[model samples]
Target: MAKVTFKGNPITLLGNEVKVGDQAPNFTVLANDLSPVTLENSEGTTRIISVVPSLDTGVCDQQTRRFNEEAAHLEGVTILTISVDLPFAQKRWCGAAGIDKVQTLSDHRDLSFGEAYGVVIKELRLLARAVFVIDKNNKITYVEYVSEATNHPNYDAAIEAAKKA
Candidate 1:
């Protein structure tokens, strides 16, 4: 288990993290259209999994919005914002926030996304703030798991890594 904190309080998380050059774990998630989306199922696209705790929080919201804006200028890379939020809620949040570039996928059904991605907060129903850049073959290239809950990641570096993929 990975020891992390929620608002400075202790919380444990599953430890199935994918490392550099490791193939990303396969899982099913629900898209806004209620269709199942799987990272391993896609072909010919580099995927950026922007795993966030929840869209309701400030940092998570900012990350999603930033990725959405940055994705517009990139090519051949699909930015997916993965969260435990329900598909409807995610869609509403994105629409209200004017986020149209990144696709939000929910882990509400099976919670497998957290397990698969190793970001799920085991104590509370939350996910950790993480960024993973997967190449066209689904190999994890860059990964950042924020130790603190309040901090935002290096936006410029992540975008550059995604661009290089």
Candidate 2:
């Protein structure tokens, strides 16, 4: 498991850590409409999965917005922002932020994505900050388990990987 810290305090993460070159794990997360959005739904498109603890937080909000802005130029890529926030809150945040390009999905119900990606923070029940870039064939090409939960991820490298895919 990757070492992670929240607010300078070490937190234990649950599940197996994923690495580049591995097959991307499939997880069912709820879209803003409360409908299930699975990895299979994104088949045939390069995907940038931005995992955050919550959308209401500053870092998570910025990360999602950044991806939304970049999505316009990424012709064949799909950007997804997964968080443990409820569907209602996620939908409201997207509406207020005018975030259309990045699909904001909620993992509160099942924690499927969090557990599968080894990002679930046992103490807080929130996901640690991470970034994953999966190719159209569903192979992970880039993986970043951010050392600090509150910090932003390497946007450039993740974006470049998606572009290449």
Candidate 3:
């Protein structure tokens, strides 16, 4: 179980999560079009798995926007923003935010994506905020599961790691 704080309240998560050097877990996430898009389909490309509790929250929205701005410079990589939000909501938010560079994927239908990555908060029905960088070979090279939900992650460091990945 992973332990993190939500507004100063301790929250314990349940699962054995993926770590750096582990074979990244595969998942089928919903796209904006409500189509099933599998991680395997995006193989051979560097990936950034931006796992968040919810996109509706202030921190998550900021994170997505930050990554979207940085994504343009990383020409051959795919930035995937994931949350438990419905695909329709993800689509609407992306369109409203002008979030084009990052691909917003949903975990509403099933949380296999959350469990596989070990970021699911079983108690809250949310995911632990995390940023994972997977290389072209599907090897997870960098991982950061935030210890506090209310806090934002180190975007600069994550970007540097993703660049290396």
Candidate 4:
């Protein structure tokens, strides 16, 4: 597992850490309408999976917004923001923030996505900040487990990886 911290405090993360070139794990998450969304749903398209603890926080909000903005320029790439926030809360936040380009998914129910991606913060029942770029072939092209949960990810590196994928 990748070492991560939230607000400078260490926290346990559960699950096998993923690496580049590995097959992307399939996990079910809830869409804004509470519909189940799995990794297979976006097959045949490049993906930018943005993982955050919650969308209600400042850094998470900004991170999602940044990806939403980048989505417009990345043709053929599907940007997804996954968090432990409830689907209802994610929908509300997306509406208020005008985050249309980036699709927000919730892992609150089963933490499927969180566990599969190795971002599940055991202590807080939240996800650690991370980013994953999976190619259309379902192979991970890039993976970043943000060392600091509250810090931003490497946007440029992720975007570039998505472009190549």
Clashing pairs in 3: none
Cα lDDT of model 2 by residue, 112-138, tens digit: 999999999999999999999999999
Every model's Cα RMSD, please? Answer: 1.4, 0.6, 1.1, 0.6
Arrange candidates, best lDDT first.
Answer: 2, 4, 3, 1
Q: Which residue segments of model 2 deviate by more than 4 Å?
A: none
Residues 1-165 of candidate 3: C-alpha lDDT, one tens digit per residue: 566777888876766677889998888888988899888978989998898898899999999999999999987789999998998998899989999999999887888788788787767888889899999999999888889987888888888887888
Error of 2 at 71 (Å): 0.4
- List, residue by residue over 1-165, the lDDT tens digit for candidate 1: 445677888777874877888988888999988899887655588888898988988999999999988888889889989998989999899889998889999988887878887888877777888888888987888888777766787788788888888
lDDT of each: 0.84, 0.95, 0.87, 0.94
Candidates 2 and 4 compared: the better one by lDDT is 2
- Among the numbered candidates, top lDDT falls to 2
Error of 1 at 153 (Å): 1.6
lDDT score for residue 67 of model 3: 92
The 10 consecutive residues of candidate 2 with the worst lDDT sum are: 15-24
TM-score of model 3 vs. true structure = 0.95
Report the lDDT of model 4 for residue 29. Answer: 96
Candidate 4: tens digits of C-alpha lDDT, residues 19-115: 9999999999999999999999999899999998889999999999999999999999999999989999999999999999999999999999988
Which residue pairs does candidate 1 place in steric collision?
none
Backbone clashes in candidate 2 total: 0
**Among all windows of ten consecutive residues in candidate 3, which has the lowest summed lDDT?**
10-19
